[model samples]
Target chain A: MPPKPQNLKNPIIWFFASLIVLWAAPLFLPTFYVYLITEILIVSLFAVSTNVLLGFTGLLSFGQVAFFGSSAYAVSLLIKGTSLPFAASFFISVGMSALAALIIGLFCMRLRGFYFAILTLAFSQIFFVVVYKWTSLTGGDDGIVGIPKKPFLFFNINGPDAYYHFVLLVVMVSLALLYLIIRSPLGEVLQAIRDNSERTEFLGLQVRNYRLASFVIAGTFGGVAGALFAPFQGIVTPELLHWSHSAEPLMISLLGGMYFFFGPIAGAVIFVFIKEWITGFTEYWMFWYGLLLMLLIMYLPGGIMGFVSEHLKRGKDDSR
Target chain B: MEFSYFIYQLIIGLSYSMLLFLIASGLTIIFGLLNIPNFAHGALYMLGAYFTYFFLHSLPGVSFGIALVLAVVSVGLIGAFLEYVPLRKIYERSHALQLLMTFSFILILDDATKYFAGTDFLSIAIPKLMDGSITLPGDREMPVYSIFIIACGLVVAYLLWLGLYKTRLGKLVQAGTANKEMLSALGINVPRLFTLVFILGSVLAGLGGGLAGPLKAVSVGMGETVIITIFAIVIVGGVGSLKGAFIASILVGELNTFGVVFFPSFAMAFTYILVIVVLLTKPEGLFRTK
Candidate 1:
């Protein structure tokens, strides 16, 4: 049973159609759903950003929160401490994340596999410690409270609906940009590195530089997500920077299907909803969640998108 | 700083270092042979403490020594199950999957412990026999339990070195660590050996946890805290090098002790700083037995 050639037309249309629906969703939905969708959008962006490293570049970093949490804190500080506008704060925080990624990635690029993972975890833990112990500056464990949703440029994104719309716009644009990166020539080299870095190097590519580029891209967008998250949540805490929190984006990327561009988006949707539903019933949701993740890894290592695409292919074959 | 005060801190740091070596030795052993960095290794350590607490409380008149042994054995059995079940399926998978699988174990084990032990920090009392302290010169006093921990670490290190170098099975383990395929081609039951090594590793973690119980507040999050430090020791020492783990543990322990004295505000960042520096300078570690 040879596989049939796939059609790309339907997916492109579906992508745009879904975007339109998402763009207009807050208007028809209730306030609660508006908040949930905003959360999903932010999480999806973060997961997608992380997947650039994990799935695309074949690097598993456990320190992404260094970028995300730092950006969140930076944005929160800028918005509260200074009279800077929201847009200025957002770009500054994201730029800060890119700089951090460059510095960290320079050192981290030398290692591969488990060493890379551990080194990243250690570096991120440094962020966690600094954030946790710098009590006078970061408020320590008490965290920064009452971070208001400042106006983005002319629009007053102070209310839930306005903020939801603002997040939706930013996330959609970010996702579009990430999609472009994944489809670019640089993206091709990254995927080549993912499949076989040694072979790609023999083809005369600078593997370390490409890896650093991917790391910076991921960190910048992760910062984008974090910047948006600070105003949305109205608070920031050191826990956001902890190594454990770094697992969330990676898990989301794995859950959705790492290979696909939209896998993490699907994962974020399901993850947020499942988490909300589970936490509603039991305080010990992590037990069930861990059990679910274990089962998924054992049986469905391909994740939701992989499973769905496989079934769709099977269905096409059967019809043929 | 006073010379006596520095010596007291040195001794205190040595005790912490020895306890770290106990847990890290198990982690390095499992990693050496099994090639799986067991993220749940810390959770197993936590379980050891919890199980010791459980046995000591539930059975009236059981001594701490007996309870610690029982806890270690129980943890070993759990380790066996882990090796046989979920872990067995992922031996040939990518490092990402292996790490995620082991990480899942941490979540399951930690949550299960939280459900059983409650979230409050629980303290285990020092045994009546080792409860007292010895006063040194300059009026510095050190707990007998800390001294016991240091002694236990030295004894275990010697025994592990002997077992690894002196015994036939130990030679096979060393061979397997260097080349698993050749060992498998030569008709060794690699899987069974992996299970045995995993059990051995778990027992060591459990012992470390049980020993650490009297010193620190035993809580669900204790594993998460120590696991990172243990990882730093393993990486700095070079993974699977027992001698490296021992020296690195001492380095980390002493650096931390002195770091607090010299740079109190930045004390928490010292170990991570060491990790970054070591990783940057020598990613393979200070010692590479493999």
Candidate 2:
């Protein structure tokens, strides 16, 4: 019998190969396609942030957009209104989002399960209301427009290719950091907490603290994504802070199957492409989208990553 | 606001609470008996309202009372069909899957309404009997429909109490809630019981929506707006507990009414604030046990 391919034994190598493909795709794809890839990258980072809590710690947050929206608004305002450079505004945007997450996480991370989900949702709504009502600060429903793209250090990052590369670099760094966190001992503890929080607590782990740490980390990444997203989209609106926006990450995580490290990234790609395609056909996109979600949940609960892993396992068994 | 206006607001708030109570009580009972949190309850409510609108429109001179009865029954049957087909298979699965399935129903129902009813607000004409306004002692006039809604809520609440605490079916439902495995072990048909509970819940939601049709804009996305608020009330009241649902409904209703009066700009955020405060104080909710 033929020996099994070396790639079958190692999934990480496949992931790297996929990364190379993603990096090189922009070079060959059209400008419009490159913009779409940038969106996929940003959304992937957002999904990864959410997966940290959902897949690792069994926490489902419905207010993840609060961080994302707040950061976007903050960065957009700073870049548009002040004379601050792009680098400074970007850092400030991330810092503001992280700070907001820390404060909200302190109060929210105390609750468990459904209550936690509701709490986060409530907080996000509060953020939305504040942004919507505070016309002076957030520009109300019209949204903050005319946000100029910042130069990448000395180089102009305004062009589609330059913006794409900058976003690619940020996403790559974020994913690498996330991968490291997931492989560490801390990640094992988080998995244990998800499986059985009570047992983990009995084993002398600070479950609440660990969960909070994870929450803050997730929020920071989410905030970073939002900060990048504002410049990429060239506007920041209260809609970004809406509960529906939060659902995007949740749907992607579920679509990708949270159990796998790269599930959310794959889910983001499929989700964006499907959304783009479906919206082109009809205005009742939500109806079809809802149907798709139901199908995914019922038939492919493990998501695309789960599908791939199962296929690989089946192949191995067949060869044996 | 004047004292009379305050009284009027209170009445309106209580009447709104009545509709909320009917829908939420059904949800609470189903959650109690079947251990399934039906996320589609709001969608069912929206369907009920839309059906009432169409029925009233198609049949001129039909009394609001008869239209409401037809709406409730039709919605109840639809709810039963939903349970018999999809929900029945997932009863033994995880709550996560159950949530996903019902959540899917929201999309299907919302789009179906948009397709059939069109994406616009529809209103039912108030019946002739409820057209007149009653004069208060302070020379204030109030709509008779509001009073009618309050009476309906009280009657439904009393009937529900009797049904749950007094009837044999209620006892069986309570027993099922306590231990479904044990109830089934005793040879009770749990699946049929679940279907009954779901139908009954859907009927109540339909009734609420039918009643609310006159008071609020009967539109396609109405369910989406109210579902989150209803979920907050259920959570605040403690899931699966009728008494908790009742108290929380009133609490939320009053808060919303008063919050608007006091802080007009921040009124939308008030319900969420109440939810956060309630969760922080009692993580299991105000009345949840274990």
Clashes of 1: 0
Deviation from native of the Cα of residue A150 in model 1, angstroms: 0.7
Tens-digit lDDT track for model 2 on B80-132?
98888777777775555566568778878898889889987888877788988
**Poorest stretch of ten by lDDT in candidate 2 chain A:** A1-10
Which number leads on lDDT? 1
Stretches > 4 Å off in candidate 1:
A1-15
TM-score of chain B taken alone, candidate 1: 0.98
| DockQ, structure candidate 1 | 0.75
TM-score of 1: 0.97
TM-scores for all predictions: 0.97, 0.93
The ten-residue window of minimal lDDT in model 1 chain B covers B281-290
Q: Which candidate number has the best DockQ?
A: 1
Q: True interface contacts reproduced by each model, as a fraction?
A: 0.65, 0.56
RMSD of each: 1.9, 3.4
Q: Which stretches of candidate 2 lie over 4 Å from their true place?
A: A1-20, B59-63, B92-97, B288-290
In angstroms, the error of model 2 at B251 is 1.2
